[model samples]
Target: MNTLYRLGQFSIALTFPALAILLAVFGLPAVLLFLSSLNAPDFSLTNYEAFFSRGANVRVLLQTVEVSVIATLMCVIVGYPTAYIFAAASKGLRMALLVLVVIPYLTSFLVRTYAWIVILGDGGLINTLLLELGLISSPIPLIYNRMAVYIGMVHIMLPIMVLPLVSVMVGIDKSLSAAARSMGARPFAAFCRVFFPLSLPGVLSGSLLVFVLCLGFYITPAALGGLGDAMLSTFIAAQVESSFDLARIAASSFVLLGLAAVVLGIFGLDLSGAQDSRPHPAWKSPPDWLRSFGAPTRRVKELAARHRAKRWASTLYQAAGRGHLWKVVGTAFVALVMFYLLFPSVVVIIMSFSAGPSLHFPPRALSLQWYRSFFNNPSWTDAAWISIQIGLAVAVLSTIVGTLAAYGLSRTFPRLRSTLTMTILTPITIPSIVVGIAAYLGLLKVGLIGTKTGIILTHSIGATAYVVVIVSATLANFDRRLELAAKSMRASPLRAFTRVTLPLVRPGIIAGALFAFLHSFDEVVQTSLVSGFSVRTLPLKMWENIRHEIDPTIAAVASMLVLLPVAWLIVFYFTLWRSRPTVSGVPLETAS
Candidate 1:
């Protein structure tokens, strides 16, 4: 009876908060999506039918898949070599390489996509340099094309591919190649026969991740692709913002969601098999025959082996010894990517300071004319303010709800755990434009459309899944026994959570919050649908400006955005470093 009472108390403590978060952020929003798709004067499949009937929608869906597949393929091709190099390199070199990869990820995706515009556009750096070098008399048609979209998307998504590949690669036995060589296999042949097959899981997993992410991409394609190069996300946005057809948008979203699920399911199955099939390589001694040669033959063999080992070791040592040089080179590479990512935004910033009425890069002279103009314009300022407010609200709410969901789902449970995980991650799989349209249609009856609250709620919903994933990762590595100990000391669950669990996981929670804030701050499609004339966000304002002016002030805004997050990351890293012991602490228990 006493044990039952304790169990009841635990259930009460855990269930309500988890349920509240799940229903509000995950369950309710999904239910609303279904209702919105079905709600009409009469129940019908007309939305789905209209979706198929529209040739443009079909084209957009196909284009989205094409871009995603191409980008993911490019990521794998590029990322595999990069990850292999990192895994084989010495520790210092690996860390430096990792830092280089992470820089692009830390920066804004919009900014990076914008940077490609500056590089690929007519009269831009790439064209100007090529022309100066007499490579071509005319600028190439690079920007506003399918190729540009692929390049931009790949640049932003490459780190995602590389990180996962690196994780898997680190687990590979370094002596597998040596073992194969001892069996008389050549170096290249050994790699082909052994190493490549072992790394297939990482390749598939990374490719799937990049592809799914690319499916929902809007900023890169919208900024880089031509009219005919539109992807599903861009098309859906156009539907909501221009056509305002809620039903068609919902149907298109459903198609995107269904396709993403199929792709992910296939990849998930493959990953499961791959995980189970991993072979543990065992080391073996050199053959006795080889060890028992005549003194002269043994001496020759010894000399040859030493020579070969020295040659291989020298090659690797030389590469590793140049770690400092590689750091500099990696830093330069990262800086170049950053410059490319930030160039358009930097141009916009420069233009914002233009003395003239029109937008210009390398402003004739510097003035805060656009800045004054922007502030003076009520529409732009109002939108900017609304976006800031919505972003902050969404960031806080999503972080809190997502952290709780992460905690609940991270606990041991039945098969329902995987189902719940899928539910939490579903928002990311669904196209944002679809989410936007669904929210618009569903909320119309609830009077959420054309309201600031509606926009905040929508952004929060979209940001929650990302937060959950990030926070869940942090929780996965956390020590739960600390909480148990606190509970044993007579601390209530809330107190134990507040005093123990919160501090330990604060870094991840903050990281999740920062990501959520940036996501909401940069969101365009969903915000466009829910936001009325009265509630305009910064990205919406930027979208409007890009459509009309093609000015440098946008660049300026983007540069500022890039700097703020980079600055936050710096502080975050410092805080993380300071919190850790200089000496290695005791390791936590791992799952069996």
Candidate 2:
């Protein structure tokens, strides 16, 4: 008991479990992979040279950056106005709108990508509608193109872009814009000057998040793109399957990693602490320069003076009508964005019930055929059961270790906490394919490859990161005085936590556990690398079916995955309701 108490006093000790697992599974292997890439002890850039010498490899590398940038830009264009509208909305409306955005964000990635295939294929919804209308003689080339790749990627990433933007935008004081307007600034000018500048942090963070995730894309490109549109992830996947060459794979992985790091450095997210929030001088030079509202306000004052002679009542009525028109336009825009985000999932759910042999939207007849096929097939059932078991194990392991780490980090020095936190999050932030390659090398050395244990460990690394971030956000708002009060009453540290701190943060713990499960269940890229074909999780099975055959039965599996998010929301609602007065202040997804 004395030993246990002494160890608990050292907050950093609580992070050991998470750090140990991360090092064994990822950090050490990554170092080895880098060494192998350089032919260590007698290092050379031969592998890198060989990689660049291939013209096809060079093209693919450039193409990956191109696609990621374009997709990120598209997300910003669509997401900015939508998020502005979300911020301006009433509380009830904002929550409803946020739910709409988050549902798609939480949906399975592969399922979302597959939803596009059902909609854009040669015989898909659009083509079928066109043929029925007799607008065209034959199907247009919609699927398997660069355009489809962007459409699918933007669909998947839009919520990620919007959530952070909304979190930041919602926190901006509306009165700042009102103050600008009261100073004779027009609504548009006030927004451009006051609100938009205040929201720049969101834009930087959202775009950075979307761009980095896009860099490591593997499944979406593979599913939606043609041979000419291959990204680096697809290229790396090809190498893994064909050559199994360690140095080449490592070199390619590092190149992709380097691209992501360079972008991250350019944007410069201060992961060690909060961004420096002190306002900068408007006249400051590039990089530190801030936009000035002075010019826009001065111009608006001139316009107001010119219009001062106009009848005040007439001008007021005109402005009211214009406000009504803007509301209508904003409503339509939000509805359209919601449709783009959700229609694919609806199509998949409807198609799952199709009685026909192939996928069809508005299925000619609804039946239980696909669902029946899913259950009757032993392979599918076994794979699902394996995934469930692994998800549960991962959730249990990740929640305990991640919660402890979050608690420990909370008590540690700020600089040390930030540095350790960044290290922990690397698994999720970097390219999935790179993480997979490193995991493959790690498991191979331990002979855990092709085992269920290998897949669980790999999944746990990423899952634990999610748990830590969520719980840390909850902890940030937690009042330490409560715990100190309990300690003053003669309670042990562990007893005080289990009784006082634990109940208050129970909602976050529940959320972290569920996210951990979802992370493990939906995982595919890393799982594919470590599974070695001996253990098949549900995602692996679904991916194989998507690549090898167009199976309607897979739609049944996907439809089930779509419902998982709804279940999560229900669970969260109940958990939060029971634990009223829970932690607030931090937005959950924003921390993620």
Tell me the lDDT of model 2 at 310.
52
Best by lDDT: 2
Candidate 1 residue pairs in backbone clash: 345-555, 348-552, 348-553, 348-555, 348-556, 349-555, 349-556, 383-536
lDDT of 1 by residue, 86-169 (tens): 787788877767766676676666666666665678866678778878999999898888888888888888888888888888
User: How high is each candidate's TM-score?
Assistant: 0.78, 0.93
Superposed Cα deviation of residue 543, candidate 2 (Å): 0.7
| Candidate 2 lDDT (Cα, 0 to 1) | 0.88
Candidate 2 residue-pair clash tally: 0
Deviation in angstroms for 570 in model 1? 1.3
Off by over 4 Å in 2: 270-273, 279-319, 581-592
Clashes of 1: 8
Off by over 4 Å in 1: 1-57, 130-138, 175-178, 181-184, 269-382, 581-592
RMSD of every candidate to native, in Å, equals: 7.2, 4.1
Clash pairs detected, candidate 2: none
